[model samples]
Target: PTFGEWVKYGLPFVPVMALVVGLYFYFAFRRRIQVKSLNISTLVRQASRKIGPMTRKEYITAAVLILLIVLWVTCSDRFGMGGPVILCIVLLNIFRILRWQDISKIQWEVVALYASACAMGKGLEATGAALYLADRFVAILPDFMHSGTGLAMATSLFTGIATNFMSDGATVSAIGPITVPMAIISQTSPLMVGLATAFASSFAHMFIIGTPNNAIAYTMAKDPLTGEQLVTLGDFFKHGFCILILSFLVMWLWVFLGYWRWMGFINGSVA
Candidate 1:
């Protein structure tokens, strides 16, 4: 099913699920309040129950994070938040926000893995690997199907599938320049390829190594970059495979089922 159809069909049920969860939490909190052992009676208990215990360093870190976030939101056109978050983490290590032990707690390997992948993507783009493939596909698309909705769908799907191996940022950055021109050549909207790249990059998370989140999670138990973690290659792929497939299906639906153009583009006309 298209993502739009799925969302439309699923929306009514989501609120019901939300209510059930709310009720569950409400009763659970009530029951906890009634229990003397867990009740907020003792000073020690009150102190221990604090959510985020802010130490001197933690306070500084919090301040920095808030400042960074504010600047990021305000200056989004001028500066990106991702770089700031990364820099903040690095500073946390440098300034001894916690300690060597705390710094060690951060999974540096996963960072390296993601960084390496991004670099690899740059290499691929610079070497014309992505463009070569995109051009080949564009050349082969028949005249009848070259510029139609079907062609757009095909291009989107192809980019999505290929991006399973290529990281999303890389996929978009690497393929954007190439595919936009190809779309022009094929008489299709460049936005089609751009949207496809975005979706496909997100869709790449099907493979454990495809996304930083998956890598970081695995690196918590094992280093993905150095292959020291407990999670095996097979294990990562096994879990990631199903999720990626579902993501791809949903995203493709979002594109083909009129959600993309309906939400924007072409004078707000529905697909």
Candidate 2:
């Protein structure tokens, strides 16, 4: 979504998720359970050592990053995804913020993997395999699940499960076919189901290779002191599953309370 569209439909989403996640952290901190084991004060001290004050180069880098974010959010409709990134690269190079050596040090394989995942999502959409599978999947839903609440639950369940098998982008692409028919079946707005599917697709909780974010993080992250893998499959399934459940609950709560309609994501009454 572009800037205006995002303000209209996405503004409500942020606070809801923030509230839920914030409360979770707050209570978890209060319990002091499942929240702490390692002392990160050393790492925090290490990171803050040289970052005491923003130097000229740091100021320039910060400005460039802010500009890049602005261009990304505001001009994405005109420039698409690659333009802002490429422009940011050029700006960074011109400012001596990023050098050719730094660029070359990047793991090209990771970029290739991300690009391939995007291509796979597009290919699935173009070849109609996603549509076919989506159709068959919906056909199997019980008659009782052909209503608004049931369909929302089904969409969340299917999306959460599917995202664990592929990237979030691919899950959304694969869900495109399901949304329209789901709207018809459930007598809700197509936008409602589509947005729900898009939001739900981020619950890629079971596998490190599930989404590009998971893969990139899994590959690049390390335990600061031990140099051990920071995120394992077990961690993904354990903590991530709780996050997925919480997210689903939040989404369901909004749907049940007609918050989606309040946010203009749905029009007319949900039949």
Candidate 3:
């Protein structure tokens, strides 16, 4: 889905998300989480240490980053999602924003891990496991739940659950094609279902293998970016598990409340 559509689609739910954040802070404080285990380190890098007016290099870097985001959002279909990343890297080096030493500092192991995980996800797609899983899911769901609205919720929740085991992008790539047709078969708006599935893909909170960000976070404990422990695997799972449940509820209600239909993302009735 386009960024504009996603922004408009979920804008109404921001208050609910804010309240959830408030509750999180309230509970965390009540539990003394901030006192007991909140480990924060000085994030000062070389550029940040030079507390002065914006430098020309800094402006250039910031501009490049903004352009990178725009390209990623607007040109993803034409260039594929990974294209912007590669282009951004090259541009950064060309402009001296990042040099060979900076590149050398990167943990190649993490890159390898992501590449392998993506390969595995691609294999699942090639083998048609996505379709097989969908068929099995529909077969097991009750007859009544096969309707448009019910199927939307079911597909979303299923997508959310599935995403925790694979990268979010891969999950979307694998399931988007299937859910669109399934939505049509169920007399639902294919666009709505497709959007729901895409959003659900971001619910990959339970496993490091599910997303590159998760994997990188998992490595903070041992990656030497920090001299001490930053996060343990168990800690990641515990916090992420809570976030995952929250996301599932919010997503379900977002659709259940007719937000998609109201926003014109769903054609015809949301029924």
Candidate 4:
């Protein structure tokens, strides 16, 4: 029911993703980008002007944020991320960094949507629906077992496309159950398939409804000059298509270079 394992399993793809995304953005946006020259003194003056000086509450909040980050990074296994976050929230409230009114203003519906998706994911696994989907996916692939590279590409492509039409969580929930089992049946690494699927889910930039983040970004991009939406659906899809292709290429390169092997995911027998 949990896909948390995919995060650790997907670490091998991190560098590939970083390089590809960095290079792509650099080339694609370099022309329109402008840089302002500044020295240390200028930076200091600018910072002073913009931020003035931090107050006691700001310092306290900064300390809490640092503590929360340390706990999340170093003690996630022992303390868990949620505990530190809850503790920070309590501290913030008790210290008056945040108030009940601010907390009440949060959109609870978003939280409920996430909770419902997780519950549904659990149900899919519990009811064996995931396995059934895996079998079907494997059946469709036919000779995917003999071709690890092909399987990875196919899975990533499928996930990326599916996420454009639905929420990332829902797409992952529907496909994650199948990814690992399909990999196993194909004589490939389940870690590879799971990671591929999970990463692909993050490329949901084509549709406003694809993921909450996309929706939020679209909503925030109101045209200041013309009072219209800043980006159209066609624009999003066009950009997303390019990024999707780039992401797939990066994933393919990671597999080809045996980066997963360096991460101890690929053994001699498993592709």
Candidate 5:
């Protein structure tokens, strides 16, 4: 599902997210009081002066990206996101906008990592490992099995914790089949469980290598200009743990508020 669907399904979390962000900024500002803050106008002026206008190639690249986004949003059902992406790349190659050398230079290792993770997830499902795990998990959580809120919270917590150690894709792939069926068995909405599990998978900030985005951010911390490691492992764990906790609380609140009920995602008690 797209981000819009996530928003629609997760509307109850909106207020929780807002509160979390507000508190984050409030704390951040308090911590920054000791540092010399740059004037916003001066910073903007300096940034504007340093940056040049986009070139023709840059504009073309931006347009292509926008087009791809539009296709992914509008034509996903008909063509799928991958089809449009592949088509865009093929067109770019055919038009000489991107060279084979440029493609070769792309980080294939990251791509391979994701592909392998997905394959492993599929393998786990195909081998009944996911089912075995899910059955055991459900059996242990007999109390939560009869309640939609409990199930959602449990799934979110499980996926969130798992994603900290494994890639998000792999975590979801392994847990999704299990949680979805568990939700059904409990008479809860499978859609809610699935979405909750998927969203929780994105909370993989505790470990730098847990997700590709985290890995990319960690790599970027090693500045090419200064060769400085801007972000440390301690920095990730310190903040990531808090964020994970807050995320779990927000998810719990969202489900407890019956917002999913308002969205027609769940009705009555799963019990």
Candidate 6:
């Protein structure tokens, strides 16, 4: 069972992980180089310079990630899985590998955002506000679709809005729990509703501090070809809006068309 679960969740890591393992052994044995400490301050200084941004390997890895993102965005309709999100950590690691000499560039500040977002989201969930809101929304749902697509869409949209102000993981964690029962009560597949929630939450990257992953990436690229670490919240918003819109559309289509029947949302049962 444990192995099966790993197989299920770990499929996304296969190729990239294999390369990482290979690189690890190669450095450990062939280069005879000692593993140094993760030095964030030095890396931060170095990355903020023009020639200090990336190494050859870092450039290659980032290129691969960008290619994968393009492929995933173009092919997600047929692939049925969101590829960019899965590959994000790997892409982030490219910066780590390039700045092996300086660990400070890892940006511990962003980790705080990740932790706090989750905590805030949990606090919201504990307050039962998500449940109360979900219940009210379901009660007022129009006669559009008895299967609860409207409710799911609204839930996802609300979740997205909350994520912009709070943390994406926190938003999902807080409201996601309540959505399950509401979805089931409306005769919607809890799974499809869950997917919508997940996708919408990921759209939180639209803001600078909304998602730590985005913040980390932005910090690392502060001295990109643009030569500055002065990116404001608006700068990120401008870049993220289109992607956010696209993600919502993808979730809506995938749920309503592909997973709707699978989630039993076509049924008229309300319990």
Query: What is each predicted model's overall lDDT from 0 to 1?
Result: 0.59, 0.71, 0.72, 0.75, 0.77, 0.62
Worst 10 residues of 6 by lDDT: 1-10
Better of 1 and 2 by lDDT: 2
Query: 1-271 in candidate 2: lDDT tens per residue?
Result: 5645545555666788778877876775576556466679988988899679678888888898898888877898899767988998898999898999999999998777656766765666678775666567667889655656566667877888888887787667656565656666556666556666777787786688787777788787897898998668787777677777887887777653457666554342333
Clashing pairs in 1: 168-201, 222-229, 223-229
lDDT of 4 by residue, 181-242 (tens): 77777777766677678888888867888887877887788878887987677877787788
In candidate 1, stretches whose alpha carbon ends up further than 4 angstroms from where it belongs are 1-52, 66-70, 79-133, 142-152, 166-173, 215-239, 255-258, 267-271
Highest-lDDT candidate: 5
Best by TM-score: 5
Ranked by TM-score, the better of candidates 3 and 6 is 3
Question: How accurate locally is residue 149 in candidate 6, as Cα lDDT from 0 to 100?
Answer: 71
Worst 10 residues of 3 by lDDT: 38-47
Clashing residue pairs found in predicted model 4: none
What are the per-model C-alpha RMSD values against the true structure? 10.0, 4.8, 5.5, 4.1, 3.6, 15.5
Model 6 gets an lDDT of 0.62
Q: Give the per-residue lDDT of model 3 (tens digit) for 138-182.
A: 677787557566777778888898998877766776676567656
Relative to the true structure, candidate 2 reaches a TM of: 0.70
- Steric clash pairs (candidate 6): 39-103, 39-104, 40-103, 40-104, 41-104
lDDT of 5 by residue, 88-196 (tens): 8987887678999999899998788777777876776788776677677778886844457778888888899999998887778677877877776677777778888
**Model 5: which residue pairs collide?**
none
Ranking by lDDT: 5, 4, 3, 2, 6, 1
Please identify model 3 stretches exceeding 4 Å from their true place. 10-15, 18-22, 33-53, 68-136, 218-232, 255-258, 265-271
Please state the error at residue 222 of candidate 3 in Å: 9.2
Candidate 6 — which residues are off by over 4 angstroms? 1-131, 224-227, 230-232, 259-271
